[model samples]
Target: MAQARENAVSEAPYYQGLAKSMMFTIALVSLAPLLGYALLSGYQYTTAYKEKVEAHLRELVLKHDQSVDSYLREKVAEVQVLGEVVGGDRLKAEAEITSLHNALVRSHGSDFVDLGIVNAAGVQVAYAGPYPLQGADYSNAEWFQAVKRRRVFVSDVIFGLRGVPHFIIALLVDVGGEQWVLKATLDFMAINDLVEDIRIGETGLAFITNRAAQFQTTPRRDMTGEVKLLHNILARGGEDSILGRGRAAITVVDDPVTGREVLFVTSPLKDGEWFMVYQQDTADAFAALYRIRNVGVAVLLLGTVCILAMAFLLSRRMARKVEVADQEKDMMNDQVVEAGKLASVGELAAGIAHEINNPVAIMVEEAGWVQDLLEEGLQKDDNEREVQRALTQIRSQGARCREITHKLLSFARKIDPTVERMCVNDLIREMAQFCEQRAKYANVRIETSLEDGVPQVEASQSEMQQVLLNLINNAIDAMDPGGGELDIMSRAEGGDVFISISDTGCGIPKANLQRIFDPFFTTKPVGKGTGLGLSIIYGIINKMGGDISVKSVVNKGTAFTIRLPASKEGMRCAAGNGAAGEQPPADGGRSEETGG
Candidate 1:
């Protein structure tokens, strides 16, 4: 019969495939949410950081704007006090106006570089300190025009008679219906100090620009009072919507002066004519953001690794379970195949036994009848003695044939076991006699140790005999090509009878120890083993409520031990019969032969 090979302890490919699939699923499930959370959190944190910077920049710009307003107010108020106290008509008296200008210069040396009194026609009527012009033309000048119209004006930085960059705070005074302008030149040193002191980062910058897109406070010392033409920073989207609209706003864009990516925050002065711009390198401003993003990435990667590790371990465990289940299923299939073979063999043996039984019986009767007739008809010695001896040989051979037929019948399913209490040691000794000739032929020794007090076991007498005979035959065969000792041992312990059959032969390997009981699994050469000897013995012992185990060492020896209940009380209860006896039937049927 064709049979499939059984595997009990190997990993299968399908199991690994399933584990891989499970790991993928787990990784996706775990990593998706982690990535999303990282992205969202990073974005929100960066946005908050930018907003905080914008708020701080606004506060700084507003404080600087207030300081600038106070400084200009103080200078302009001084000019007003001078114009009012020393009237414009008094300023026509050169001596008196010159005395007042000298006193002002002494009081405010850093702020009042020079003072000039100009008439409505823009001509300097009187001047003091530094300039030789007593009547310099002031008509058509931008400051003169602004003063005439607005009565007060703060001009952009310019280089006039002084030939140095400075601004003029002019006050318009009307005395006796004539307008005269008092103008004072103020340098931008104070404003520059304030802008420079506003600390941001290593690459941070601060500068002021006017409404006309002209730089009021120069961003760099080389570009002082020279930066004029520039685009409005706040009105990027639309000219009308965002221009000078926001009190303070922050943006990330390329800097016009540095031509590098920067974070620029604009805080328009309350006057609306000028604005303070704060610039920080984008890398510096958002460095915290980059750190946060890096942390998020690290956390996500770590979580993914942990999840994948868990998935791998869980999948491996599941794969092991699948492997074990497959091995069990294969073992079951092997058992089924073995059972079918046993059934078929039993039926064939029964049929053959029945066919040969009648002819063997007839031969035995005929041989006896000839021996009796020869003894009654023949006289004296002569041919009668030879005839009697021949008849006796025929009867003996016929009886041996009958015994063989009975042995085959015993293997048939139709024959039920008759459980009886029988001495295990006696059975072992009786079975060994059959193997003694074979041992002698091979020059092997048979040694036995039967404990004197070993109890009898309740079992099928014929089956027990067959079990011992099979074990002994296998032990003999294992020592092939050489002679070895076969050791048979019997003892009673714990109300159980134990029989150990051992041989000094090439032993079974450790790897195949468990598989030795499996049907058709044998290490013997082809045609030398049917591989069913041990399997059949296992089944028979289990049916009789006994246990069997084996131990072996390579190139040294192998041993098999069987355990059977030896108590008469337990046996009587187990078999439901009172068949404990010291002897078996007189037929002494031969055992069904099996190979190892």
Candidate 2:
């Protein structure tokens, strides 16, 4: 079975290509999911990174707000302490108040712009430092009223009467039961420095806003006044932002000033009316994510290429394996076919030996009888008839021996096939004549249905006759217990002639059907039959550019059908064209059937 499979592969060159195609298909199927995963993961990573940047901005805004608030609270606390130490009415003394303001300003790091002492009636009784506002009226001022109501106030950036951008920190004190306010102006430089200290990603900017959504400390110091109101950003940002809500949170928005998509984090300062706004461009923030995506794509492409390369290499290896398998099969088939031919030759040799031995034995006995008569009487008249009979018997036996040797020589002669148009019925009749007595002895009935005017086939008569003879013998032998029918039929159809030999006998088993034409495979008992009969027959039909097939059922019957090209020219043309691979030429060749 393995050899037969190998031979089929050897005969068909396209099988290896088929194997390669299959491997390629499998490789593609395996790669589909992996490719999808790589693409999906890259997308997901970028999305997550965007979210992460927003989250980080949320943290940064809170920290920045804390720093600003800490500075403002410290300034407010210092003023509150001064109000407690100095009495309200006594602060009307300008030298004592001016010295105290100088000490406080010196202690407060460079943020203190100026200081003023105010009476309950909204009058600045004393003032010190950079601004000359000692006599400045606070009676109708907003800070004077706010300080009296709130006790302490950290105002947003504003220009004082001195025409400078300095926000105020005011503390209301009850000194000796007389209401007084210590009002200090904080330098805008300190607020600007505080907002600028928040460092974010590339293209990031930080700014502070009052409760009115007006920029307090703008990145562009030139736009730091009321003109830098964030009209669109605070308006479009939800109710919480519009209302100056205090919760620290992050949002994604398009910057109104820069018109770039950015991550915006809003955190309220300690005063509750101030906010620290941190904005980072989305493109800059997700830069690391882009690199990760690129690396993933590169690795994915590399893996896909490697997979395809391996698939190609493996497919080539598989194709080579198929090719090798085919070669081995052809060799094995050739070996089996040759073996069958040799075995058949050996069987034929034995049959001829038996034929020759019989005639030779008869001649020897007859010669002995003549010798005895000659010894008995040369002159006796009575022995003449007996001597003459012995001589005649010897002559007849010698002629029989010569005839048997001639038959043996004719059968042994290796001759090339002669391509000719011949009636298949005639060939069948002649071959059947040799096996008739054997069938009769076995109680087997021979039947023939030779169609008249059947198209002639292009074949070698001698080889065709041998093929028919082998099939007939096998059919007869299959009916081991006798009383079976053997039917031989010939017909013409579809530009071909079909000859079928069928037997009603013990049939071939299903398991053995495929192997029937294999060398030395037989169901017959030992020494009863050589398995080469069907093998030789198959080889002959195949060489003639014909096909043979068998149908059988166990214990019922078996039929073999042989199909040959109906017109001689058809087969002859096919042969001439070399259509039958590795077979003989159109003119002639022998079907090598021999016995051992």
Best by lDDT: 2
lDDT of 1 at 543: 66
Candidate 2 accuracy as lDDT: 0.72
Residue-wise C-alpha lDDT for candidate 2, range 102-173, written one tens digit per residue: 887777766777778788787888888776787778887777778788999877788768777889888887
Which lDDT values do the candidates have, in the order given? 0.70, 0.72
- Model 1 / residue 191 / CA error / Å: 1.1
* Angstrom error at residue 224, model 1: 10
RMSD in angstroms, candidate 1? 15.5
Compute the lDDT of residue 345 as modeled in candidate 2.
53
Q: How many backbone clashes does candidate 2 have?
A: 12
Question: What count of clashes does model 1 give?
Answer: 2
Can you give the lDDT of residue 107 in candidate 2? 78
Candidate 1, residues 7-97: lDDT per residue as tens digits? 2213356777878887788777877888788778877887898778667777776777678777777888888888888777777666776
